[model samples]
Target: MGGLNSNAELRRLLEEIGWSPYELARAVNRLVSPDRRIHAKTPFAWRDRGTVPRDPLPAVVAGILTEARGEIVTVDQLWPGQAHKTEVWLPAVAQIAPDRWLPHDTLALLKEFRASGKAKTHFAVSGNELTSLAESWAFGNHALMSNRMTAGQGRITPDYIDYLEKDLAELRRLDDGHGGELVLRAVVNRLAEAIDLLSDSSYPADLGRRLLSLAGQMAQLAGWLGFDLGRHGFAQRMYLLGLRAAVAAGDKQLGALVLSCIAFQQTWRNRPHDAVSIMGTVQQGLRSATTPRVQALIAMREARAFATSGMHSETSAALERAHQALARGQHDHDPAWVYWMGPTVLTSEAGRCYLHLGDTLQAEQQLAEGLANLNQDATRDRVLYGLSLALAHARGTGGRQDLELACYEAGQVLPMLPEVGSARCRNLIDTINAELRPHRATSTVRTFIDKFETMKKAKIC
Candidate 1:
C-alpha cells in the first residue's frame, strides 16, 4: 500500500482535471456550505500527510479525485490489499441469488469506493485496533454499555467515530438479509460487555462525557432497529435509556440528538402528534446545549415533527431555526461529532420537513442542493435523501425516470434496514405511491410499486 498518497494524488488529479486546488476547494465548499462562507481550509487537508478525513469525507474525496482523473482510485488504491473483492463492504462482493440474498450486495459497495480512490493507505476495517477493544468489551462483564452507559474509555479519537460509523454500515448490510432482529441480538450481546467495562472501569474523570455520548449512540442504534421492526414499545424504551445515558454523560447535545431518534420512532408509529411532543423534549435540551451542531439537529427533528403533523407554519419556522443553528457552527467546533452537522444535513432536513408539508417546490430545491453537497458513501442517509427526492418528483406524477432512480437508491438498504428508525422514510414511499396511484398503469410507476412491495415484505424489519 502506498503511503495514503491522497495529497499527492489529489494534487495530480487537479492538474488532470484542469482544476486548481483552490477551485476544487471552492466547489466542495460551495456544495457543503452555500450559506455560511466556505473557506479554503476545507479541502486542502487531503494532502496533509498527518491528517485523515472523517467518514463520509474520505469516501467523498476518493470519488471526487477519481472523477477528475477519469479513473477510479479505489479503496484499495487509497488504503490497499487489506480488503478484498469479496469484502462485505461491497454489494457485488456477495455472490448470491437475489431472492435468497439475505444480505445481498454486502461487499458490493466497498469495491466501488476502493476502485475509485488511489491507494492512499491500507486503511481496511481489519486494520483497525479498535476492533479488538470493541470485541473484548463485548465479552467483558460491563459489555452492556458502549461508552453510552456511564463509564469506560471515551472518545478514543475522532477516527474511532469514523470507524464506528463504518461498522454501523456493515451492520446495516447484515441486518438487511438476516433481519434487524439478528443485528439487535448481536449488538445487545456486545453492548453488554461495554456495560461491564463501564460499571467496573475507572479512568480519567473527564472521559465521562465521551463515554455517555458513545453509550447513548449505542442505545440509539438499538432503538432504531427496534423502530424498524415495528417494536414501538421496545423502541421507545430503548430511546429512554439512551436519553438518560446521554444526560448522565453530561452531553446534553447528544442527549437531544438521541431524543430525535425517539421522535422519528414515533413518526413511524403513525403518531405524528406524539412525534411533535417528543421533539419538544429535544428543543428544551437544545436550548441548554452549548453547540450549534446539536441545536441544528434538534431544530431539524422539530421541523420534521411539525411537517409530518401537517403544521405548515411550524415546520417552516422550525426549519428556519435549523438554518440559524447551523449558521452558528464555526470550523472550530469539535471535528468528531460536529463535522457531521454540515450544510448537507441541514438542507436535507429542511427538504424533508418541507416534503412532509407538501411544499414540493421548496422540498425539491433543498433536496437538490443538499444532495449536491452530500457524499455518496453515507449509504443510510443517502437512502432517506432519495426518498425525499422521490417525494419531490411525485407532486405532479410525471417524474417516472426520477422515481425509478430513487427506487435504485432505495435498494441500497435491501435485506438490511437502517438503524435510524425513521418513520418518515417509509412514509415517503407511501406518499409517492399515493401521488402516482392515479397513473399506476405506467411501467415506471409499476416498477416503483414493485420495489415498494418488496420493502413492505421485509417483515420483522
Candidate 2:
C-alpha cells in the first residue's frame, strides 16, 4: 500500500473517523500482531510519504476504517490504484470473542469482507459464519453509529425528522419514474445534508432516534440507487452505512429491511448462493418480525435465489409461502418501505423465476399479467419485464410466430428506453441483443435489431 500519489484521501478519511496517526497505528498494530508494537511514527511516515505497508497492513487499515466510519473502506481508497499488487483482498486473520459486545474490529472485518472481491468469488458462506454475525449484532453491547455526528449548537425536532422522512419518500418516487441515474445525485446530496444536520443539531432522545431512522431511510435509498446503477461496491458500502444508521436509530425493522434489500440485489445479480446465505441470516436476525409484508418480501427473494440455482421445486415452495405471506398483509398495516410491494411485484418475480427455470409458457403468462398491472410511470420495470418476456418467446419452440411477438416486445422497449435512464436497462437491452445475434438473418430478428439501433442513434443525437 505505498507509492506515487497524494495522501489527501487518507488524511480526509482518518479525520472523518476522528482517528489520529498514533491511534491508527496502535489499532493497526493490535490488529496485525498483538505481540509486536508499531510506533506511531510509522503511520505518520506512511500518511505523509505515501509509504504503503506490506502484506495484511492495507487490509488492517481498511478494517480499522470500516469499524470507525461504519462503512466499507477499501485498500484502493486508502491507497488508490493498488489493487493489482495487493490482490484486492480482505484478510480473515482475526476472530472476535463471543461476548455480547460486538468488537469494532470484528464488525469491521465483516463489513469489509462482505463487500470485498473475495465474497463475490467465495460465494459459499456457511450458517456457522453467519450465525456468528447474527449473534454479534443481536446481543452486542456496542452501539452502531457513524462518526459524522458530534456536539452542535442547533436544535432538531420531530417535525424536522418528519420532513426528512417525507423527502425520502418523494425520492423513492423519483427513482421509480426517472430511474436511479437521474435521481442518485439527489439521494446522495440529501443523505449528506441529513448527516450534516445530525452533526450540527441537538434534540430530545426520542427525536434523535427518529432523525437517525430518517437518515437510515435516506442511506437505504442511496444504496438502492447505487445497486440500480450497477455500482455493486458502492451499493454494498451504502447498505452497510444504512444498517449502521438503522441499528443506531434502534430501528430493527429498518435493519432487517436493509439486509433483505441486499439479498434481493445479490439475487438479481446472479449470486443466488450468496443471496440465499444472506437471506438465511436475515431470517435468523428477524425471527420475531411483526411485519407480514416484510416477511413476504423476504420469502419472494428466497424464491428468486432458489430459482437462480435451478431449484424449481424449492422455488415453487418458496413462492407459495411468499404468496400466502402476502395474503396476510394489509396495505395500511405495512411500512412505507413495502408500499411498492403487491400483486405486480409478485407476478413479475414469479415470471422471472419461471423464465430461469425454463418454463417459457408460464414465464410469458406471468410476465404479461405483471405488465398489465404495471403503471406507465414505472418505465424501467416495464422495460425489464418486457425484455424477460421477449427472451422467453425468442427461446421457445413456437418458431416464426413467437419470433415476431418477441420482436414486438423489443419494439415496445426501444421506444421507452430514452425515458428510462437506468444503466440496468441498457445492460438488459445489450443482453437481449446478444441473445438474438444467432438469428440476425431472420426477418423478425433483423427488424428488431435495426429498430433498436435506430433508437440508440436517436438517443445519442
Candidate 3:
C-alpha cells in the first residue's frame, strides 16, 4: 500500500463490482486449497501498490469477477502485463437469437468469418455457449431455405455437387495421413470456394440444400484442422458457422455430427463437464437418426469426458455402451463420416481414456492392440496413439525394464513425426520426454534423449 503506483485496472474492476479489497481476497481464498489461502489484506497490495499475485491467484480473481459480473473478466484485463501467463482464457457466451439461424443471416456470418482472418489470440468460447448452441441445434426447427437466385445467376447441377463431395472426401483422407497443419490451408481454400458457390450460384431447391450441406461439411473440416493446430478461437467460430449451414440445410444428422466435433474439442481441452454436457445434447437430439456407428462414437466421446473427470464408474459404463453399440454392427444409413469409426479406433480411444484415468496397464493393452491393428497408412493416428502407449509404459509400475520399453515405443513414433504435422502428437511426445528426463542416467533413456534432442535441432520431432 506504500508503493507510489496504484493498480488502476484492478481498482476499477473492484469498484464496478462493489467489492472491497478484503472481499476480493476472501473470494479468491475460497477457490484455492486451504494450504494456499491468501491473507485478507493481499488484495489491498494488489489494488493499491500495483502488485500482481502469482500464477493461479490472478486467474482465480479474474474468474471470481467474471462469475459475479456475468461477463468475461480476463487476467490480462486485471493485470495487463501478466497476460502472457494466462494459460486458458474463455470469453463470455453470446446468446444465439432464433433469427441467427436464417439462411441469409448464416450466409452473412460466413462472409464475416472469412474476412476475419486467422485468430490473433488464444481463447475458447465459454462452455455455456457451446452447450447452448448444441441445445439449439438438437431441439430447434430450422427451415430449409428456398432457392432465391435471380435471373442469370451461375447455374449448379448434381454432377458438380458430386464432384465437390468427392473432393472433400479426398481432403479428409489427406488429413488422416498428413495431419491438420499440412492440410489446413487446403481445407480452408475448399471451404471458401463452397461459400462462394452459396453466395454467387443459383440452384434449384434440392441442389441448394446439397450445396449448403457441402459447405457445412467443409466448414467442419476447417474447424477440425484449426483445432488440431491449436487455434481454438478460430476453430470455435468455424464450428458455429458450420452449425448454421447445417441448420439452413435442415440436416439434423449433420448438425449432430458437428456437435460431436465440438464435444471432442471440449474433451481435448480438458473441459470434461462441458464435453459431457454437449454430448448429452447430441445424444438426446439424435436419438432417431443415429446409426450404430454414430452411437458408438458418441458413447466413446462420453467415456473420454468421464475418464478426464476421474469418474471411473461412469467411464466404464460409457465404454461398455460403446462396445455394445459397435457389436450391433454397422448399418447402411450410417453417415460416410463414420467410415473411420471401427473397432481399432474405438480401442485406441479407450486406451486414451484409460490413460486419463491413470490405469497404465489398461492403457498399454488397449493402445498396443489398436496400434498393432491400425492400417499402415494411418500415419497421424499411429503417431498419436503410439505416444500414448509410450506414456503408459513410462508410467508403469515395472522397474527399469518399463523405462526401456517406453524409450523404445517413443523411438518408434519419432520416424513418423516428419510425416505427421499434428501439434497434438508433438505435445504428447513432449509429455513422454518429460517423464523420461528424470531417468536420463539410464543408458537407454540417455540414448533416447540424445536422439530426441537431435530431432528437435533438425525440427523434425
Best by lDDT: 3
Better of 2 and 3 by TM-score: 3
lDDT values, one for every candidate: 0.54, 0.70, 0.80
Ranking by TM-score: 3, 2, 1
Which runs in model 3 stand beyond 4 Å of their true positions? 1-5, 8-71, 74-99, 118-122, 147-152, 397-401
lDDT of 2 by residue, 142-165 (tens): 564444434688888777777888
User: lDDT tens digits, residues 43-105, model 3?
Assistant: 999989888787667776776776555356778788887544443333323223534677878
Clashing pairs in 3: none
Ordering by lDDT: 3, 2, 1
- Scored by TM-score, the top model is 3
lDDT of 1 by residue, 27-88 (tens): 55533334543457755655545244544444444544543442444544543443233232
Where does model 1 exceed 4 Å of error?
A: 1-186, 202-213, 285-289, 331-338, 397-437, 447-461
How well does each candidate superpose onto the true structure, as a TM-score? 0.52, 0.71, 0.81
